[model samples]
Target chain A: MNLKIALLGGDGVGPEVLAQAVKCLQSVEVTFNHHFTFSPALVGATAIDQTGNPLPDETLEICKNSNAVLFGAIGDPKYDNDPIAKVRPEQGLLKLRKELGLFSNIRPVRVYPSLIDRSPLKKEIISGVDFTIYRELTGGIYFGEKKLNEKGTVASDLCEYSEKEISRMAHLAFKAAKNRRKKVTLIDKANVLETSRLWRKVVTRIGESYPEIELDFLFVDNAAMQMILNPAQFDVILTNNMFGDIISDEASVITGSIGLLASASVGTDFAMFEPIHGSYPQATGLDIANPIAAILSAAMLIEHHGLNEEAQAIYMAVENAIINNVVTSDLNPDSRFGTDYVGNYIANSIVDTD
Target chain B: MNLKIALLGGDGVGPEVLAQAVKCLQSVEVTFNHHFTFSPALVGATAIDQTGNPLPDETLEICKNSNAVLFGAIGDPKYDNDPIAKVRPEQGLLKLRKELGLFSNIRPVRVYPSLIDRSPLKKEIISGVDFTIYRELTGGIYFGEKKLNEKGTVASDLCEYSEKEISRMAHLAFKAAKNRRKKVTLIDKANVLETSRLWRKVVTRIGESYPEIELDFLFVDNAAMQMILNPAQFDVILTNNMFGDIISDEASVITGSIGLLASASVGTDFAMFEPIHGSYPQATGLDIANPIAAILSAAMLIEHHGLNEEAQAIYMAVENAIINNVVTSDLNPDSRFGTDYVGNYIANSIVDTD
Candidate 1:
């Protein structure tokens, strides 16, 4: 099979880690005898510097025409420090998601047994922890109407939700649960917010269609606690945009090695894959940043394309690298391997395997 | 000092643990030569069943007239399972907070060294973790205007913030910092919401008044990750109501002992202290629920009243109990101590001390 993938290396260590992902992808192509075409595009801080537009017309055009997008992290301290900055690198990713109608963000939180000692949590709590969160990407307060009064005394952000928006993500979460542990826990603040109540109503209604799946509800506050106390009890977590952002990031820590976590955002016809971590500008050229997240992102990208065997091969190689202690300083502070070395080692492992 | 306290033991294990807290308070009264006048009131599920109102008018009157309020947990499975229940126990606490103008929630996440092994996180990460989160209460999305469309297909909740609200909590957090590590970290999603921007502006301006303290900013998503990766890095966390509810709960797990955690919500003239955990209905009247949270709440109650010596005595007693392994079943699965036994032990420890 032949496919075209858009590569958006946003800023900082983005390009460095993304380069390793591409290297591993190339190895997968050779091992599987598949042809994958890659197109690079400008985004985030680098894009802002080049064209003064985070998501330029040409970049969107490339992504719209591609089969899948593999993104590097975005953000720069320059924009972060100036809270009033009119344009930021994050706008690029948000605009792209809105443009491509990427409504569902899938973050798979899995604990690697070998790295359990790195976790702050007890091993028993996180040993068998494996769950996926389906977060609504394009709706909720993030996209709601925001206002600042004339006197700047009062500011308000609207959190609006419609049945259509809730139903779309609910269907995706329930469907995914059918293939996994068949349990869907909807996280919302229904006790206080009408938007949350609407979420419960719509999700509960949609859940009826999936009789085989177990459905439950938890307030977002309690859900946050459960994520740390008993994460293994969850199979699938479905929540709004804001709650999803906070909960998924909180859950990311359960994996111990955040550098190994990967995420996928999907719509009906478009999907984008990326590491959950942000651009660490301080480590841009250090060659010490972990590339495992980006490599796993590539694996998710192919898995979305229905190449299960090829994706599993990439996953296996990355797992082998970790098991063999071939990683950047993030996992092992004294490890001798650099970013490129880990990527090259994983790629070699892929080709060396059956 | 003569103080009048209102005790609201709401439901389930509420009464069980509260009894122990009162016992310890009595011990403090004798040890410190302070007269604490106690008044009992019904609230939450028990109140709803007896008075047909979660926060009875009489209960509110008692809290309004008292020097401080000491609360046990609230919530019952019967009410939790029914998503559409109009009359609920939580409404009572919400109403009390609004009526008394309890606008700031202070949750101090402290890791007890003896129970560091109970944490899911590695001991090294949580050993010296001690931070307090100043969450703005009675404002933001929780108390904002909520509306459902005519067909109930769409719902909206407003997240509004004012300079007065943000400034009020900023001063408290900064003042608290002066007594601690002299650092404040404000968590908000300023890039996405206008309200968050307003928070940044107001907080930044307030930060100028305190040149001695270090001030930093983190988006809520990143703050969630930092809570686990480096909780000890934070001395004071200032955030909005919703963000506080979620992040504080997430921080609660870092302590590894939710039953031992305590919280205080304060306004200019009114304040309430309570355990961070909810009423476990299953453990109602079982005499096995941990009372340390409730006991520590009494400690906060005295601390709030400017009785530092008395509060310190209570804190010392509770610490001794934990270090000596005199805890309920929650902390030690095989422990034979019941709720009353632990409470009696703590009270006796207080009297036995200098």
Candidate 2:
């Protein structure tokens, strides 16, 4: 099969990481009898610098034409340090999500035995933790109308959500649960938030349609505790965009590093796979940034493409590489970094040895 | 100085826990030569069964007349199973908060040395984890418009916040930072929610008032990770209701048991103190529910009243009791029990030791 993949190497170490992702794709292609066409695009601070638009027309076109988009990372300290910058790096990424109608951000947390000790959680606590979180990508207060009223001393943000938005995500969450351990935990603040009450009522009504799966509604507070306490009990956690972003990152460390987690934003006709970690501008060009997250995101892309065998192959190779100590300084900061060198190593393992 | 304290030992193991709290108050009174009158009232499921109103007129009158209120656990599984029930136990608590205009909930998370191992987090990660969370109460989506759509297939809730609502909380948070570590992390989802952006902008404006205090904004997601990775980095975490609830509970277990935390909900004219743990209906009448949280809330109440000596005395007694292995089963479940017995032991220690 021939696949056209959109490559979005946003800002910071994004380019360095994408180079490694390309190598992984090359290795996968060589071994799997498949062909991949790579098209590069910009969507972060770098894009703003070049085209004056973080997510420019050329970039969107590339992504629209591709079977899937592989995002590296975004943001820059320049924009981060300067709070008043009108055109920011994050805007591009958020725009892409909304434009593409990417409604669910899927973040999977799985502890690798080799790095369990690195987790802040005790071994017993984090040992068997494995779960996937589906965060609503485009709705809730993030996309709401924001304003500064009465000479800027006063500010307000209107958070409004339609039932259609809730229905679409609920469908995805329900589908994911059907594939997982047959349990779905909808995390919301229904007890307090009107939005959450709406969430509960919608999800609960939809829940009746799926009796085979156990549906549980948790106030976000309890969900946060349960995430760290008994992570094994969870299969798929469905929540709003904000809840997902926070919980996913919190759940990220349960596995290892924020730099080691990957997420896929799925829409009606487009899918964007990216490492959930932000652009570490400090680490740009330092080859020490962990590429495993990007590499794993590629693995997710493969699986999403219905190439489970190829996806499983990449996962196995990546897992083996970690077990064998072919890692970057981000994972083991004490060691010297072969940043892209680690990706090359994993790619080599996938093709040479496997 | 004399104070009127209204005590409501609601339902389940509520009365037993209140007994211990009363004892601790008496102990503090003796140590500081401070006298306070205690008037007990009924609330929660207990009140519902007796008077058909979770927050009875008598209970409200007592709480309103008193200088402060001490609340034990509430809820009954009977109500939990019946989601459609018009009268429920939690309603009383929520009503108390709304009626009294308890606008800020302060949950203090302190890692007890002896129980550090009880946490799912590594001892090193949690040993020095001390932070206080202030959640915006009586506002946000809790009071927003909730509607079930025409098809009954969609449910939606609205989350709204004005600048004025957030300003008061921001002032309190910045002031807290100045008093403690001079650093405050505001947890919100500015990236996604307009409400969150409103939070950030208002807090940022209020922060100008406290130039000496270092203030930073964190997306709720990143804050969640930082909470586990570097909890000591946080002194005062201020956020809206839902986010605070999630993060606070998440912070609770990192210190120890959910049964080992206390909180205070304060407004202009009134305050309510309660253990962070929910009413463990299963443990009701078993005399095994830990009362330290309730006891600790009393300590907080004393501190609020400027009875520092009395507060410190109660705290030392609770700590010393824990040190001496005189705790309820929740703390050391294997051998600890007779929740009443644990309360009595702590109360006795409060008197005999000092």
Q: Of the candidates shown, which would achieve the greatest TM-score relative to the real structure?
A: 2
Q: Could you give the CAPRI-style class of model 1?
A: high
TM-scores of chain A across the candidates, in order, are 0.94, 0.93
Off by over 4 Å in 2: A82-84, A151-155, A192-194, A197-212, A334-337, A351-354, B148-156, B174-179, B191-194, B197-213, B334-337, B351-354
The best candidate by lDDT is 1
List iRMS (one decimal) for every candidate: 0.9, 2.7
Q: Per-residue lDDT of A18-102 in model 2, one digit per residue for the tens?
A: 7887888888898988999999988899999999998999999999999999999998888888978999998899889877878
Candidate 2 clash figure, as a count: 10
The weakest ten consecutive residues by lDDT in model 1 chain B span: B345-354
Candidate 1: tens digits of C-alpha lDDT, residues A1-354: 798999999999999899999998999898888899999999998999999999999999999999999999999999989979899999999899989999999999998888988886788888899899999988899989999989998999999999999999999999989878999999999888999999999999999999999999999999988988899999999999999999999898877878888899999989999998889999999999899999999999998888878888988998899899999989998899999999899988885345
Q: What is the number of backbone collisions in each predicted candidate, taken in the order shown?
A: 7, 10
Q: What is the DockQ of candidate 2?
A: 0.57
lDDT of each: 0.91, 0.83
**Span of ten consecutive residues with least summed lDDT in model 2 chain A:** A151-160
